[model samples]
Target: MAMSVIRTKRGMVKPAKETPLTTLDLSVMDRLPVLRCNARTLHVFRHGPEATRVIREALSLALVPYYPLAGRLIESKPRCLQIECSGEGVWYVEASADCTLHSVNFFDDVQSIPYDDLLPDHIPENEHVDPLVQMQVTKFGCGGFVIGLMFCHSICDGLGAAQFLNAVGELARGLNKPTIEPAWHRDFFPPQEAEAEAQPNLKLLGPPPMPDYQLQHANIDMPMDQIKQLKSSFEQVTGQTCSAFEIVAAKFWSSRTRAIDLDPNTQLKLVFFANCRNLLNPPLPKGFYGNCFFPVTITASCEFLRDATIIEVVKVIQEAKGELPLEFGKYLKGECVSGGEDPFAPPLTYTTLFISEWGRLGFNHVDYRWGPPVHVVPIQGSSIIPVGIVGSLPLPNKGIRLMTWCVKEEHKLPFLDHMHGAMDQEPL
Candidate 1:
């Protein structure tokens, strides 16, 4: 649908009172460029003229406690990042679309959906002065509407971002205050003296070079029965219950790695982020915000991955997930305080498969006066990087959706066939 902007305004949802200088924690993740911004799209059946005013008012109130969101990014040091508590405010826009919501298909390939039309008309990466957060409330002909949220990833991860938006939704429903007040303990990963030694040049020196491979988008759904079958097969083989994520991740890793067809001995790595809130010694409070997760990498030779069965590959991933708690503890005790290894760093190679899960992020329930959203789509986090966003299907159909990015166009059919083949295979 063609969208026409009717108005634009800046909302200075300042804290109830003036906030003092608040520095973002200098953790390893705080330095990476990859974790810079995230976008989420919410669809509603109907919205009245008051919808815009109501949402803005709620956002203003929500910003009272989440003041950092309205702040601007500042380069504290060469390899560090921070936020200036300037109370600058976020950009809000209201627009109208020509087509009705019924005309749009939310389940189609994400590319078919006009992201520019659905989201705020602003360059995601502006060198002048980046907006920490921005939003667009788009109205359609059939009383339908969409709310798009764009936020800097440096300030928080998906979980933290959800907390902020959920707060706004709660306020829109006439709640006096959000159920949870966010906790910002930037110093959570304080640097340790032991990790002060020469650290690898984990800080990306410059923007990544242009890629030779053509990037494309793909969305695949795996039924619950197939997922259960895969899990059961794994348990039967090793007498160990495998999580849906473990089984699916292993399947994708094996299938995609094979489809890419790299050198036989090339070292392939599967990278994913693990929430560290519960992994911490004194678990972070339920409301603790900021980047609470760290990257966990599992590596194997190309030959091993290509030859290994889904069950075999899952074992490797299971071990990595099981040991992350211990590894994270060692990280905190050693160099986390002073920024040891860069956990959020970009993948060293195009061959490294990066998987991120948003299914459990609680995005579907961001109700704002008009019940919960019918569909919540992730418009951020997929770029030149080869990322696999693990999402969920709507109710009545229990399953998972694998939204893949940057697949080589030539390998598109092969990639899809490879992925679908894995799901269709009978249980071992």
Candidate 2:
């Protein structure tokens, strides 16, 4: 099915209350070399043409506090990024798809839909002197529609992006104000040593390393009972409680390693973002609107991963996560402070894997008058590593849904089989 743009225009959504010009701070995580660009997300809703109007009007209000999104990024000295809050506004577009929502199997896998057509046209870099946030509202023939958001990663992370969308949804419901007002103190962390030069020029994660091969994607659903069983099993083996994400990551890494057939002694890296919102001595103000997570890594040999039980691997991951410096101030003192070493950088190697969690961010709760979105899908730029873990929102049965991209198409089936096998193992 084809998608045709009904109207395309630029919107300047200034703050509902006029505020003076401001320069916002950019987090070291925001300056990660690989993430210095736009990220896309698609939200599916069952609504009509009127939904577009609601979103347009609501977005204008949402931009009031998130003015930086309406602004542009300036590449200044020191090679760091800064937002110029000039109120240029975000890109807005309205389009229609010839096919009905039912005709597209969006829930099964993200690849089932036409992401390029559903998302707003990515403006050429040379012509991107306008805004940081761009959106497209598409109405399907079945009266159901999809909202595509293209956000500048330099301005916000997944949580920050969700905060913005939730604000828009609140306004659409005729609320006078957003539940949480945004806080944009980029200078939250003091300046520290510049570590950009001290770090190795290793590949930052996000882009596909092998352009020649197609990565396969799949979603594995684990019900709450299964999750509890898995966690219980882990605790019995390790004598420590494990979060759902940790347990799942352990299983996933093991399966991925076996599927890829790396050398038994080869060293493999696992990295994931650890939220630092409440880790600081003086915690960041509530509702801080920016990137506040850093990557933490744990290494294991392929043979170890292949032979270790899920509980044993979970212990290693849990210990690595527990050992992370809890002081938010220390994060500011690290290489990130100087935009040097982004500890959160995705591992750049054929043997590395990244796992991320999003179940708690509440993406499924974005209610834009038409009701909450039926499905929320994240779409990263082409520069991202294709093989990684994506923990999604919980299913209705309180089970978790996990989506993953196996680096090579040939490895996908084996990976999926191994993963399911791990999850389905009965408690011993």
Clashing pairs in 1: 36-153, 189-337, 190-337, 190-338, 191-337, 191-338, 192-338
Q: In lDDT terms, how accurate is model 1?
A: 0.72
lDDT of 1 by residue, 1-428 (tens): 34353434534345555666565544555445666556556444344456677788888788778888878887866656778777666777777777676666532446667777667676435424456887888777777677877777788787888888889889999999999988876666655622432234335245566676656788889998888888877777888897888877988888888788889989888899998888765787888767777678888999998888888888899888887877676556543422344555545467778888887776766777877666567764545678787877653456998878836887778878888987787345
RMSD of 2: 3.7
lDDT of 2 by residue, 128-229 (tens): 456788788888777878888888888888888888889999998999888998887666555554344224443344544554555667788878788898
Positional deviation of 182 in candidate 2, in angstroms? Answer: 1.0
- Model 2 Cα shift for residue 383 (angstroms): 7.6
Scored against the true structure, residue 43 in model 2 reaches a CA lDDT of 87
